[model samples]
Target: MFSLPIIALLVAGAQAAVLTLQSPRFTVSSSTGSQLRSEPISLAHASSIPVTLTKDDVLKLTFQVIDKESGKGVQPHQTFLRFYDQNSGEEGIQPIRVTNGGKAKFELNMARPPLSLPPTSDAPLQVSLLIGSSTYSPLALSLFDLIVPASHPVPAHPDEASFHPLPEIHHTFRPEQKLPPRPISALACIAVLAPWIVLLGLWGQVAPRAVHLFSPGIFPFILTLGAFESLLVWYWVDLKLGQVLSYGGVLALVTIFTGKQALSKIGDRRVGRK
Candidate 1:
């Protein structure tokens, strides 16, 4: 069997350990640099009284991350402080950077609160600590409840378009076109068919005396002309213009060669008779 990679084995070992916070503490101070309340955070339960911060007040937090199996401090991959409001269901997460020795400190000033701080209200915000490391199980501990001033009203949504009555729609359309009567349409059809009808009617009279017309050289020329006429009729009925044009071009070449041959044969026969 293949063995796991060294990095994978190392991560597995780390995950088997247990992670915990040591010396977790917080201090509330005034803007004039006087401490208001200072105490070590309890890991077992939340404090009876809620921590409150007015405008311009500051809150400082300090802690050390360590593996429970080994008392030595250890830095974890992720360390965050979460503030949540149960009533509004709004929460914010602020990342805290830990040193190589696992010591961490965070400062939250109400005058310049971090953007991660969510909109607040009269309700107390639940504060908690979250720690995660590749070498150990993740740890989360509820720290305390906090109260802050009510936030301003939420502004209008930037992506929403203005809603108002729109101007009445005025549509302009082309007038209906009138078509010709059936008798006129039939007359037009006759106008197109008259030449074909007259020529076909005269073909029988001309064919009997035209001995050269059915000959090999002239017959091909006549057939090519018929192909061109058929292609025109096919285009008018079903064939596309491009297809008819392609077939016509090829037929034109054949017609040119055949017509030249037929005319040359006629000229030779005339010379011989002379």
Candidate 2:
């Protein structure tokens, strides 16, 4: 007796050998009337034709399947159509099953309206199709070139009285609309340096003995101020909060090191005095 797995494999092989895909045919229609009734064309030898269509136009594609040995129509259980636009990189998939006649049909609506083109220019709307299935291999069809026609000019009214000149509009910049100067101000520079100067004075006056031992002088204060001002300038010019915070962290580390050195010098002096 055959095992269940063996039986399943045999059934799948039989199904694969029997099912065969045929060439697809299509028809195009617009608001005016039917445009084309294409003959069955093989997927390999399929050619693209430049087709001009309006937003109201519709295209219907028909895919047929048949038995390879018997040459009879075979209804597919399920079918999937993938339509892709090459230029826009847009894609859409539609699921449609075959009918009794082994024909699966789907309609494509042209929603993108046509634009005006120069006399020597042609804008190609490139599109392609793919038919996929779980049992059979995917079928890739040839590209389709679609063209949208420019809009027609509206006719002027026959009555001269109905026509009037449009109102005149002025396009001029006013004084109030002018942009403010972007240069950094002197007041801002003073504000950033003022705090450092005040701290240095306090350290000298309030702790005169300690200042003599741990006198870092103006060099450290100037270096730290310069670094902080550079960060401030970068923040103002680039307006990057992340860079400001990163540079600020580095400045914090520098300040901490300077403070520790001053404290150590003062501690050493106290021990010496003791």
Candidate 3:
């Protein structure tokens, strides 16, 4: 058995070996079995004539990966075929399977295009082969330019428009409503308060007797109810409706409690007199 250092050196030397392809060739055929083109691929340069395929045509490629010095077939760790649409800036990589003996074959049928194919345009796709291995150096070869029928445009989603930024809202709000002249505003305010003012002016003539008006229990009920009214007035002038409602709810509870106590006291006093 070799020593550890010697074995490591041998493995490193083996991994540094160069890799190449053997008998790289492609054949284009019709669905009806008639061959349109058949030629061996050159690793030095890509083909000048682009291979064209119609709706039902098929393309078959055959190649074998080998060690450059040993000339023996090698099954690499990874192999891939890349199709790139130069104009569309779209590309796709399709993994290729190499047999244990390093024999590899790929077939492209236009009848059912592979998902790895990029959406194509009028421009030809630049085809390339890439192979990687742990034992040998990686290799890349530009194959041939391929021209196929343009793919149908991808359909848009139903909510595609919702994805885009919305147009800015330029609210055309009514210019701040100008207030009426001060004298007119004052007159309007007076008009609104006119009935109350008149009613207050005639209070002495129409005022009725309220014997329990100042009774301690009854007066508290009246004061709580009055506070409720004041809360409403505040809402009309400065406070928001929600705040007024919240305050009114609390005031209503206080008013109910006071009214109940006043009624209870009156009943007890009446019972005492009877």
Candidate 4:
């Protein structure tokens, strides 16, 4: 009778030992205009999952974790959920304490703050559920891997041109408008070349007398010039005034330091002569 009880306990312990956990399926709830939409998602088809959310849209995801062998919901205390962005490297962990039929829900606010760029549509994010003890065996269920969509879709209009036709123009007999003068201003050209001319003059004047001074300044000058060129390109192409001003401020500091060093070297040469 004692051996039979011990064998029964061993069998019960073997049944409780977890080998793997089932991947959770998700249901997403989103609102489009005045209508609310709910869609089911399978973890097995995570690679093809489409994330369709616009700015200021609210998104909700719900899923449940279960044991692979028993096909039963895993206990809340034995599981935890982790959400992370693969591109931004931002991660958040939540304890799994589901009160409703072993289902856990996560909510996300998709509103973009003022002056902030929207999240990249191509960037991937993941939600995973981990199970089992930290010291021994553990299993991870990749609940969802989805790419966020950045922009809202434009509705197609089949006869838009027909509805909004171009207006007719009338030609007036008047004197020909005077065209602007050809070629850029000479002052503008001088302003552009002035920095380069100054740098070249300083190099010529200081390099022969104090080779050490010139060599040390060369690397910084080149670096500053490179940064300035990059800023110039950014200004012309992107037309971002804030970046241009910030970079110009940094370049100004570097140029001031270079000028001070050059002046000091010239003073040293004068002192030696005297």
Candidate 5:
């Protein structure tokens, strides 16, 4: 009787050992959007996937993980869902937690904030999925992006072709227009020194100074020269270097103009610096 009990204990221990050796390895199955995987999934296989979506549409994904040997389900602590754009290389990811016997599901809404939809339709949007690994398995999806074109909502048909609405007729220039030949830097330089040059040129004619202010066309000459010079400076400072040179230019111009006014007044005794 004692021997029989020992044999029963040995059999139980062996069964427990088998179960311990049989824990699951993860596999991925996906039903994403309208696309479905048609072949056995493997690390080496390449998958061609497609999705269909309309602007402001929402989508859901259902997938599973399973044990390779016993056909039991498996779930991971953390899994990531990703959206990829094939053309522009844009992508987004959301984390999903698996529960209730290794089943995972994800829902994503398709909407654009700075919406670009149509009138236009069938724009290509490709997608790819990444699970836990850095490399995505051979599964991906694609879609067509539809955006409202600029021509949409045709401006309220003018009361008459010649009614000529002022608002419509007026051109809206891009804020980036005139772009300073570079940007704010060049524009700032022109703003700062321009007044000084103009005032100095005018003062040269009226003051008790020997400096030729405008004779020989120096005023216009210098003005034109500075304009071009500053353009190059603007490009160099703002465009090439990506630094704004205008702030320093403004401060220096203020100092120079004020100082000149003070000095001129002291020299000519005119209004204590004119």
Candidate 6:
């Protein structure tokens, strides 16, 4: 049978989706600089991209701007970024002005939306940029439509300690570049997951409080997930298993709360059930 943690993870994870956004490329000439040098910048790197994060997940958005003229970095005067809910027609996420090395580095952290309250599914959020008081329109709206459906739970404040990294994006960006290889011995994984699996099983046998299982404490959950990923990193194995297991653990908690009602449906089929 699948462990409770694994089940919980899968249940929440299955709701996640990939989101991407691209801005438009523009050439800002001094109108009469030296040698008339031109710089190259990608629309993909300049705009705020939509990201789905579960509570306590930390997200960092990096934008690199290169100057072609002096073969150096180009810094803009002031960079303003905004996050808007396309569905609600309201601004959702906002950040203070970003200055990269005293210039427009074009990179900023996409702070997660406030979650002191509940999240509404009515609106889809998007990021935007303001350079020198001019609103630079993004390329095609279709370009920046990355939407990871399941995000980490929002915290009272936006800080790294309260964030979890996204494994899917990590894998996508570094293709075929497995941080760690598969464990030579499955025993190691079994050993690691044993305790939680047992707890999950026991919970299944004696179901617990529903609220305790699904409470809004995404930080601890994400921290635990990060620890699992860190273990995989140390073991020199791909973290895919850990990622799935992370969510699986959560799902298991959910199952335990539901009196194992979903067990019968999941009994015969599980992604990596043993």
| Model 4 per-residue lDDT tens digits across residues 197-233 | 8899999888666345346645465567677888898
Best candidate, TM-score: 3
Best by lDDT: 3
- Point out the higher-scoring one by lDDT: 3 or 6: 3
Candidate 6's error at 38, in angstroms?
Answer: 29
TM-scores, all models, native as reference? 0.52, 0.38, 0.53, 0.35, 0.29, 0.27
Question: Candidate 1, clashing residue pairs?
Answer: 14-135, 14-136, 15-135
Ranking by TM-score: 3, 1, 2, 4, 5, 6
The runs of at least 3 residues in candidate 6 whose Cα sits more than 4 Å from the true structure, single-residue gaps closed, are 1-50, 66-68, 92-97, 100-120, 133-143, 146-274
For candidate 2, what is the TM-score? 0.38
**Compared with the true structure, what per-residue lDDT tens digits does model 5 show for residues 1-274?**
6769878877755543111112211222233434322223233332333344444444555556544445565554445554444444544455656664656655544454222221222334433344332221222322222221122332556565656645546787768645445668877888988999989998989877646455442344445446556756777765643233564465456546655654454466545542
Q: Write the per-residue lDDT of candidate 2 for residues 81-132, one digit (tens) a residue.
A: 5444454444445566687776677666655421222111135544445544
> Per model, how many backbone clashes are there?
3, 0, 0, 0, 8, 42
Model 1 over residues 1-274: C-alpha lDDT tens digits? 3376787868876668887778989999999999999999998998778999999899999988977878778989889899999988989999998998899999999999898888888889999999987767888889999898778745757654356555688788888898999999999999999999789889867755776778897899888889888889989999987888898888899999998998898888889962
In model 6, the worst 10-residue window by lDDT is 134-143
Stretches off by above 4 angstroms in model 4 are: 1-16, 19-24, 32-39, 43-45, 111-122, 133-137, 148-274
Q: Tell me how candidate 1 scores on lDDT.
A: 0.87
By summed lDDT, the worst window of 10 consecutive residues in model 5 runs over 17-26
How much RMSD separates candidate 3 from the native structure? 12.8
Model 4 steric clash pairs? none
Model 1 residue 128 lDDT score: 91
